[model samples]
Target: MIEAFDLFSVEQVAFGTGRWEQLGGFARRLGSRSLLVTNAGDPGDGGLVDRTLRHLEQSGVAATCFRQRGEPRVEDVERAVAAAREQGCDLVVALGGGSAIDAGKAVAGLLTNGGSVLDYMEVIGQGRKLTRPATPWIAVPTTAGTGAEVTRNAVIGCPEKRFKASLRSELLLPRIALIDPSLAVGVPPHVTACSGMDALCQLIESFTSNRAQPLTDAWALHGIRLAARALPRAVAAGDDVEARTQMALAAVISGVALTNVGLGAVHGFAAPAGANYPIPHGAVCARLLPPVIEANVAALHAEDRDHPGLAKYAEIGRALTGTCDAASDAIEAGIGCLNDLVDQLQIPPLRQFGLTPEGFADLVSLARKASSMRYNPVTLSDAALTEILQKAW
Candidate 1:
């Protein structure tokens, strides 16, 4: 059976040095009552939040704030939706990193539909479809990663299931995407690296996904090129406008690619690790990327060069690093880039999250059950999965 690929896009992107001021008019255009969704208790975001609130208030829009701190769980979305309903908000405005935006997506999705957030959750819950229209939503992305502003999927982990899943629907795509480079300026070095890797991985994984389409491939290849040139520089110097601008664009383009083409093993494995471990999603992906690449390449090569995933690997390597040396060298360089980012950012290991080899022993099962794993070009054995974990370790 043929599966059709759907292309969704940003309604508007406001990107520049100081573009938050533009929010006043746009926020007014959306609705009079705005539920301002923000990151929970980040001291740095307070001033930005204040600026946004001032703009909304001056525009005569009544606003309520929903502060979400960590990666939003199902309950967080429910709580925010309830607050929005109580406040009788007409719109949901997400303003922060991917987590905050994801929270807002969930809140917007549930406000009109009035269903359990869990009922529409991925893997864990009933996995019900959301047929109703979500509340009007404007996404304001403060970070240069995830491109959650434009993505149709919102990944929320369910602790009860011990596996992560995404709430994906065309209806859940934000009504508008507000991308402001200035918003990413003061992000910490660690965040810059992690988020940047998340962008980098999306570009690579999407370009290489089994279901890649011509449009998404164009987006991913270009995203890969931008990431190679800008991500490291952005991590080193947050205030560098040129680098920041490119990475910011890369984030959105990569989001566009992943939304249309989907992702592969890196995401497949990371979701479970995220659900089970304390490690952040980007870090886990960054750690796993090279090993997974190498494993897939090796699995392809050692089989008399008859492996199926080779073309995707070749394209991704050439796109990101440019000029495939040898397949092994290309694979190694990919791994090297990840290590360089980890070293440059000082990201910790899986063990830091209490994921010992024994802990990871259980990951094979978790990894096997993950949805993203289904997209991998080759079907890896349990032993291959364990090997990838060991290499990542």
Candidate 2:
């Protein structure tokens, strides 16, 4: 018998070298007025905002732009919703990285739903569901990470609670995901390495997640292979169009996979780490992924009962390492390969980012409450969680 599963995706998606030029047409169909959300970077210095505005304007779409500097916060989304409402914008366009896309998503939802972002957020709020459909949203990703363009949830950092949680709804998925891989050529090497590692972890965790189904497994496997082959090349030579394209494709695939199957321990810890510190989201995932993999493998071995997900790790090992071995042996080889890749990418230790003993303890407590932990392949003990952090440190 086949296991029951469901898949959710954006209404429309376009991927290629010059799809950026088609953003105007997508926007015009959505509405006459648009709100363009972007990072604070100047277009003259290689930003995509100026170009995006020009496209919208040429299509007779009136546009106003909002620039966000860092991760999307609850306050940022609130302010954006008010601004868009006051300006009478009818559509939302996210033109930069994940933060911008998440911010736009929140704005689009709140504009019609009529509530603060906290009202619909998970973990620290009422967790109310969105009753009304969001305004049409167009996601134009300039980075090859996060894959927020096609996701139905937006992560918002809550400063008051010192937690980062997701604001989610099926209605929050964008109307169009306008993906242009060539737009990622300007990303720096360090950023590419960090984000690529995030993509890699997302694929691995989702493939092994307790919620994984046949459909997500296919996407996750394809993403893992693509990321493994492309990440190093992208980091070493940022101008490689082929590598960038593969990583971009992998990132979106990882997003869709994780959305359906969920993630695991790496993201469980990374969310709280980002909330508590000034560290970048991708950096936290890069530092924690290998340790989480090792911990999961060890925990599975220690269990007296056989877990179905245990063999999945070996599959990942064989896929990533290109080796055929017994399940147990392949699992070990996969762990070693992940460790080597993390080191090769120069992902720093958690301690280097000023994570103190007290801070780590707080993070551990927060992670236990994280939504991502529910999908882990194995249930980890507090001691196990501590060991993963200590090893990563």
Index of the highest-lDDT prediction: 2
TM-scores, all models, native as reference? 0.93, 0.97
Please write out the lDDT profile of model 1 over residues 216-291, one tens digit for every residue: 8887888888887787888888898788889888999988888877888888889889988888888888788878
In model 1, the number of clashes is 1
Q: How close is candidate 2 to the true structure, as a TM-score?
A: 0.97
Name the candidate that leads on TM-score.
2
Candidate lDDT (C-alpha), each: 0.81, 0.87
- Ten-residue stretch with the least lDDT total in model 1: 40-49
The Cα RMSD in angstroms, rounded to one decimal, for candidate 2 relative to the true structure is 1.4
| Residue range 1-393, candidate 2, lDDT tens digits | 668999998988899988889988888888999988888365555456777777789999998888876999999998888889888999999888889989999899989999788899999888999988899989988888898888889999998999999989999999999999988888898889888888899899999998998988988888888898899999999989999999999999988988888999999998899998887788889778878988888888788435667789989998888889998888889888888888898888888888987776778889999999999988999988988889888
- The lDDT, on a scale of 0 to 1, for candidate 2 is 0.87
